[model samples]
Target: MPIQVGDKIPDVTVMTMTAEGPKPVKTSELFAGKKVALFSVPGAFTPTCSAKHLPGFVEKASDIRGKGVDEIVCIAVNDAFVMGAWGKSANAEGKVTMIGDGNGDLTKALGLEMDGSGFGLGMRGQRFSMIVDDGKVTHLNVEAPGAFEVSSAEYMLNQL
Candidate 1:
């Protein structure tokens, strides 16, 4: 089953770009001792993802953070380099953390994987967002396929 409120985020390795290079982060450590606002895109740089999804978080980052969220994270089923470039292009530096689930390890662990073979995107994560407090999920908003309502930053902010 997919991850849900009250469940601890799964411990899996995900990548993040750094000055040195792509680095691995353990979900257990990343979510520990903090309230994290996390959202996932199917893939980086897609139309809806670029135009709406990621930007919403980037625009409302401070407002969201002000509500006691320790950090905001954006994840996609793409390589670290692509994620890094997307973050830079979207001006998400310092405002949002970009994570790359290149192998879909974290996505699969959460049971949020979706197939996009029709679009030639292969396996990817569904559009979703969640509030993780000290490693335990407190809220989860998963968008239906082809839908964009609940997972938006505005919706997440309202829940805060």
Candidate 2:
């Protein structure tokens, strides 16, 4: 089943780019005692993701954090290199934590993986957002295929 409010995030290893290189970060470590606003994109540098989805979060990072969110995270199925590049391009440094679900492990664990083979993209994560407080999901907004609405930063801010 898809992850929902009240569920604790799975303990899976995800990658984040650092000064040295890509490093493994456990999901449990991320949510252990923080109120996190996590959003996922199908892929990094894709049209909508680059133009709107990611920018929205980057623009609203402070506002979201102001509303008691300890961190804002953006996850994608791409590798740490791609994610880091995209973050730099979007000026997301210090505003958002970009994570790489390189093998779709986190996406699969949440049952949010989408088959993108038709578009030659292979397996990717569906666009979604969630508010996790101290290891428990408090809110989840999942977009329908080819749609972008509820998962936007504006909507999530309203929820907060």
Error of 2 at 146 (Å): 0.3
Lowest lDDT 10-residue stretch of candidate 2: 1-10
lDDT of 2 by residue, 51-115 (tens): 99999999999999999999999999999999999999999999999999999999999999999
lDDT of 1: 0.96
Query: What is candidate 1's lDDT per residue for 94-132, written digit by digit as tens?
Result: 999999999999999999999999999999999999999
Q: What TM-score would you give candidate 2 relative to the actual structure?
A: 0.99
- Poorest stretch of ten by lDDT in candidate 1: 2-11
Give lDDT: candidate 2, residue 99: 99
For each candidate, the alpha-carbon lDDT, in order, equals 0.96, 0.96
Task: Please give each candidate's TM-score.
Answer: 0.99, 0.99
Which residue pairs in model 1 clash with each other?
none
Residue 15's lDDT within candidate 2 is 99
- Cα lDDT for residue 85, candidate 2: 94
